[model samples]
Target: MNHINEALKHAEEEKKTRSMMSSGKLRSTLEEIKTEGNKAFSSQKLDEAIESFTKGIEVYKDNQEVVKLEKCTDLTKIAISLFTNRALCYSKQRRDANVIADTTYVIENLSRKNVKAYYR
Candidate 1:
């Protein structure tokens, strides 16, 4: 009985460690996507930038459960940036509705105090 309990505890610890590792990996991946989007945006590639940002947002949304479980503010900030940057791209393209939708999402869901979102 004692040995069985010890084995169970070990398994639980292993599971937790794996979860943490995966969380870190996801964060890194998100950061990379954000960087790529920024680069594209800086180069005046609105379409490419929008594509990268959208992909990042989708990836973040897909792993929201893990993000919430980890309680990482960094992930939330990255997500907010993705939306805000994409909104900027939409604005450049004169996509008023798309800009409004993205900014509204940031204002309504991510950060109510996001000045760029409010201004856009």
Candidate 2:
């Protein structure tokens, strides 16, 4: 039973990896960086978290590294979530305007694609 469970878990993870890989993007790695950013933030390591978050955003913004999902609805959502998380980090520094700025960036990017508008 234990072996079967482990195999099942591995298979699920592999399927996710395959999906990400087949998408022809650095979204997976960027997401990993975002995760690291969150972990760093949790540990009160602001500088490390900001670096990781910036790296993730850079990867996401790279033209050649874009996900081929055409519509990219999901990716946009992920981007917004990351931006929101970054906003929270900025908020910790009592930079409310910075939070609003990051939120505005997320909103503008989504709207630029003519996707749905989400008020931050």
Candidate 3:
């Protein structure tokens, strides 16, 4: 019984340790990606910006820390920025399909305030 209990505790501790490590790594990568995306956007590299933002989003998509309701606000902001950049790029290239798709995604995911502010 003692050995069994010890084994269980060790297993649980290992599980928690792994979870914590992954959480921290996910957060760090997300921040890095966001910063890179912003830099790319400022440099007029729209496609690269989109790639960075999308990769960051994918990393956080299933994280419990990222899934919290409070984090949605920031997530929405990222989504809006990415989609807006993509839309603008499409507009410049005269790609109506991409522009509509990106615009629709931003409107659906972002807050009404953001939608109104961006459109205006």
Better of 1 and 3 by lDDT: 1
- Residue 99 displacement (Å), model 3: 2.2
lDDT of 2 at 72: 61
Model 2's TM-score against the true structure = 0.64
* Candidate 2 lDDT by residue in tens digits, 35-96: 99999999998778877887776666653224544656566666665677777777788887
Candidate 1 segments whose C-alpha is farther than 4 A from its true place: 1-21
Q: Which model is ahead, 2 or 3, in terms of lDDT?
A: 2
Candidate 1: which pairs clash?
none
**What is the per-residue lDDT of model 3 for residues 1-120, given as tens digits with 9 covering 90 to 100?**
999999999999777555642544555666677788879878888778767867765665545444353454555565556556556655656877877776775566555555532562
Error of 1 at 118 (Å): 0.7
Better of 1 and 2 by lDDT: 1
lDDT of 1 at 17: 55
Tens digits of lDDT, candidate 1, 1-120: 999999999999777656543677778988999999999999999999999999999988877777787888888899999999999999999999999999999888888998989987
- Model 2 residue runs over 4 Å out of place are 1-24, 64-69, 111-120
